[model samples]
Target: MARIKPQALLLQSKKKKAPSGVSVPTIIVYILIVAVMVFSLFSTYKYWSRRSILQTQDGISNRKFIERKKSDIPNYALISTSKGQITVELYKDGSPDIVNEFIDFSQKGHFKGMQFTRVVKNFVIQGSKIENSEATEDWTSRGKHYSQLNTSLKHEAFMLGTSKATHEGGGFDLFITTAPIPDLNDKINIFGRVIKGEDVVQEIEEVDTDDHYRPKTPVQINEVTLKHKT
Candidate 1:
């Protein structure tokens, strides 16, 4: 030891020293913490998503709902199509503007002869644009402009609504959703919900669509007939 060089002594000391390491329990605790944090974040995200939808619904509650006799609590619309028919119950009790606009349009035959312009499986099947009703086998002939309808309704599956008609547009065009679309609730002017012919809506959504969302085989909205319940 007395003859050993300073560098050699230092090396020997280092060699004898054990490497530091975390205990097994400490590692397990860290893993549990990470897992809990991940779960907490996921739970929080889910909670907020649900809360947002509810908030939009609450907003809908504040709007004007149509007053009707007890027997006529639910209004109805018959959407006749090539594949089949879909019957929707207008949310007239809680959405008057939306229900009124739809009734007016249907009585005027504005929804007839419109094709299923865009169809996305499990999401939405957009109806032919109003301008396209006059077209021959084409929807792009008229400029893409959706007329805005005056309403405070929000979009939801089966419910009817309107907005400007651009990619950022709403109102003039129509669509039927096959599933719940929380994102659309706040942006769309919803007024109706499918009651009898939901299967028909599902059938249309099952149609084959092109890359551009156009159905390979056309599904026409043969006509939209409205009726009041007795």
Candidate 2:
């Protein structure tokens, strides 16, 4: 038998030995892969969480809702405008938050001089505050921002709804539907319906508007008078 050289034996042994530790590049790649997975999971959870919250507000998710007493809430709101008075029967039991918020804003004269900025022929008549150059409109100025959503509430004809610009919570904007907007039932907060003055709403809807649906002859809300239950 030929004796193996010591140098060759040493080289062979070195080759047989396993690596001391993983390479820095391999470890870095593993870490990056794990981080990506974690971030993806977190993003998914966040999206579902927000969606669930909205569902809960809509009374579709598994959450209990405490209702407020009708006596404590306003019964009706008389929206006096340039055209005529629009009497809205408040949905005190259905959307207390929105009803109360509307009362607060109206009593404060927030919509006193506001204009009906948008009008869709057969859709909706939207009103928003006319902000002065020195003042910027901020929905947060109101107490608590609410995105009132209830399955029972619907966007029927002449239904008074919560502001559409509620992404930043809520706003003083109000919209009256000209026709049944079933699509908006789950999207917007329906707080009241026209108890009277459907003709006035029709009259406003008939006004000539610009390309953007703005009333050529400016229409404004002179006052909003709340009528509480006796």
Give the alpha-carbon lDDT of every model. Answer: 0.67, 0.75
Which stretches in model 1 have alpha-carbon errors above 4 Å?
A: 1-74, 130-157, 164-171
Q: Residues 1-230, candidate 2: write the lDDT tens digits.
A: 99999999999999999999999999999999999999999999999999998977788423333343446567989989899999999997788788888888887788897899877765678787642221112222210112232324345678899654443324578889877665666546889999899999999988988765668999988998888741
lDDT of 1: 0.67
**Candidates' TM-scores?**
0.53, 0.57
Clashes of 2: 0
Q: Could you tell me which 10 consecutive residues in candidate 1 have the lowest summed lDDT?
A: 141-150
**The 10-residue segment with the lowest total lDDT in model 2:** 135-144
Alpha carbon lDDT at 101, candidate 2: 86
